[model samples]
Target: MSRPQHFGWFLARGFGPQGWGYPSLDWDYDWTRPEIYQEAARTLEQAGFDLVIIEDAPSLGSADTIDLRVRHAFGGPKHDPLLLAPYLFQATRHLGVVPTVNPAAYLPYTAARQFSTLQHLSGHRLGLNVVTDTGSARHFSDSAQLGHDAAYDRAEEWLTGIRSLWRSWEEGTLVRDPDTGVFADGSKLQPVRHRGAHFAFDGPLNAIPFTDGEPAIVSPGGSGRGLGFAGAHSDVQLALAPLDEASVRAYRAKIQDAAIAAGRSPADIKILFAIQPVITSSAEEADRIVAASAHPDDAALVQIARKQSSDLETDLTSLDLDRPLDITIFGDHVSRGSIQRLIGDRGEDVPLRAHLTALARTGRITDRSGFVGTAEELADLIEELGDWGNDGVLLWGDFHPVTLHRTLDELVPVLRRRGILRREYDEGGLQANLRAF
Candidate 1:
């Protein structure tokens, strides 16, 4: 893998409690602080990151949530991601800003217009992470939250309509035909009338066509419905699993297969894994920071695991953390077993105790391992993952944006020196960045 490969910055106000792969912050940090986000964005731009993926969650499920609950108590100074787009766009010249949006919450026409406007404002630097509401029904009106497959079905139509509206006008469609005294070419614009199972659209969008086409589509989901959509349209496919070689390989293979099945080249979609790095001048210092950091409570760990586990009913929190993890605990959730297989494939032949500790040390080590080291050491580890089975990495931020900030300042340059990271922004827009792969 060379400098042209994908390396994106991941954000979630990591500085607070529940930092990446660890517990949240002590006192909840003020996420709305402009200086906070600005510093983070500046770091990534300096480091030559391909994009900044800012995630959005509607709400925490509930109070008294178990440990590892992604729903936090009081996330700070939050604002709509769309409103923040220009802030990040203005902060960096080339870093793509990908913000997730749910089609269910807003009309497709409105979203199309917003993103098209964003495309013009950002100079085509925006990317879209299309989501079809994997959340609970309570988040929407009684009529909105449809079944899973139905949601995707509706999404397909929504995307189709959005695309049509984007091409509604061609470049130079607005002609200064002063001879005819015409302000625009009317024939070049067309309305998209779509009537699908879940949605119906019949009007032309309010904004002009974005010549670059809709921002590069990214899908974080990989379930049957998700893979089908992503394989057909997504430029980047986000995967979350333990950071182990086998896990990385298996996930990538599945996504490729999905892409191939969708009648698109498997290489069209890049697989991105979340990785949080702790960097220092020396590898030992990085190791010390990781070692010194406290793991979130056992309950939190189990709850986090439960979210991805197919067998959500099984409560792993009650089990003794000291006890050797019984594979039987994953009974019925074949996916959980698949996760365990990844750890076992690592070629370690230690006793059950050591294996258990290895599993516990990483908190349900499905396959991925965190890299804690100096910049050079971290870059080497990234190279190792690239060799193993990673297209690129999504650097997870802990403590607001501090983890990402440090990475851009310290680690990225090391990778660049080794010819593993880009020295300058790739020419063109967000879609161009993803298409370069």
Candidate 2:
């Protein structure tokens, strides 16, 4: 029998209301209100989703100037994901709330304490999505931005320190007794003293062990080093890959290999691929929605280029649109995965302008992987991928409430009927629920 697959939602805005853009006015309630997020959380819980991940970027935009970013609200004026977790937890019983956090921006001690507190309060339904700030180093601190691998190196150190802190207070240390007037067994508490490459921390955590265990750790990245970090540390790995069985299978194998090399069980880490599904009653309506979401003209194409420029940290506007791109010029500034997707097998001779225009037209450059069809068709696609060894998928839409509702109302039922998705969450916290699969 095929085991049921796990499901999670990727909240692109991190509890913010900017995802649907001005069109959100159609259903606009106060974006600042916590009720909106709570409602979404309740819906997910009802649908039997394992978790909801809040994606965040402290710095937004990659253009030569901040004008475009400001005009579009591309990456600014966002609310903290951490603040929304409590609201979500209060509104739901089983759904895990995972917030994106940059270790570079927060000290290990602070991160450990904050997550530990949330884990306790939420009944161990908390998860931390560890991400590194790649835009600019100055945004994080006065120090220079580290290179890709170096950033992961710092993250590894950060995680090590955080884990030490979490383990500082061992189980059975809290003995709250009135007869002897004893509270904690100090002898059982040990100090975590560490002097590492990127951080130095000493002593035990101030918080008590509140959950069944430490809060679950989630890691998102596609690079080799990123995979290694996830294999070694994360209970869940959020992967981005082309929507094909072969590609996904290869990626899964790579991750499992990394886990084996790290002296960890391959089954311990779950890999969830990011998917954007556009489901409507018919294929035509879904196609129409996809078409409407794309860039309509040359000016819009330029806008896409500008966004890519911001991501690549280079001025793409100056390059001739007709000329082939030289990938080496961008060096390590741009994400390797982005570069691979942009250039593909066409080689460096692919025209910069024409390529960007094509990407804008198809919405591939901006939206990436998407499936346009009815809910049944989507379920078929998902089932096929799962059969190819994918553990699960991270579902996302255009950040419209309608889209999310349709997914819950239409798509999830189809998946459930196929016996591929869980009918109900297992009896446990997030970690136990995740590991149950």
Candidate 3:
């Protein structure tokens, strides 16, 4: 029998607007209330999804101005996902609620205590998606930003300290006997004295040992240092790799090798591909949606350019859209991988305006990519990828209630019938459920 595939949803806008421009007459459209998230979590739970990850960033994009970012809602005005976690957990029983936490933004002690407390309250269903903040460091009151590799180094130290703090109080540390005067076992508790290059902490964590161990550690980055970090530290690694089977397999192999080098079992680390599936009832309808979704008009083009410029820290507005772009101008400001993907097969001499326009028109600039087809066709694609050594998929949709409802009510049932998806969650916490497959 085929191994059961894990399924997760990538909440790009944590408790915020989804399906930015798309019509959502069915949605309540009130983002401030937790009802939308609660409803979404319930839907995923009913569908037997493994987890729901809330993606977050500390700063708005590196754009020259916040106007575009706010106006377009590309990366502006997001409430903390951590705040939403408790509400989500209360609303669902089995589905894991993983919130993104930037190591750079939070102190080790604070993160340890917060996550540990949640883990205890949620029956160990909480998860932490550790992110190395890459947005403008100035936003965090830093005079200068660390280089790419150095940031990961800092994250490594941060995670090490966090883990140390979590282990401060061992199991059985608490001995609450009403008859006896002593309420706890002092000998069992240990203080964490960790001094690292990036961070230092001295003392035991405030929280007690978690019932199911530490909250699941999730790492998301595709760079060399990122893969290494994920292999060594994370239980799950979210990847946004190319959709081709060979490329995906190769990336998985790289991560597996890193895990082996790090003295970890390959199976201990699960790599989930990030995908956005466009599902429709019929092939013709699917084609129409895909075609419409691919092409964005003038407003979308501006929004895309503005978002990219903010992220790359380069102002695309100043550059003439009709003229070719000088890649040299970006210098170290932008990620090389991002630039390469944007340029694609086109030479550097290609006009910046044309590039952004093409991205806007094609709707390919965003991180979301996957098949546009009927539910069964989409399931086939997911299964084929899983058969090629992928652990699971982290799905992103248009965020319309109808779209999400269809994915859960329509697509998931089909997968379950084919034995591609789980019929019910394994009895345990988030970590156990993750390791079940």
Which structure among the candidates has the greatest lDDT? 2
- Model 2 weakest lDDT span, ten residues long: 360-369
Q: lDDT of each structure?
A: 0.64, 0.78, 0.77
TM agreement with the true structure for every prediction? 0.76, 0.91, 0.90
Worst 10-residue lDDT window, candidate 3: 361-370
For model 1, give the 10-residue run with minimal summed lDDT.
Answer: 359-368
Model 2 vs. true fold: TM: 0.91
lDDT of 1: 0.64
Write candidate 2's Cα lDDT for 233-336 as tens digits: 98899988877777888899989999999999999898998887656787667667677756456677677777666556566667787889987777564678
Clashing pairs in 2: 62-310, 63-310, 321-353
RMSD of each: 5.8, 3.2, 3.2
Candidate 3 lDDT tens digits, 70-167 = 67666666778999899999998899999998777877888788888899888899988987766646666555677778888888988888888888
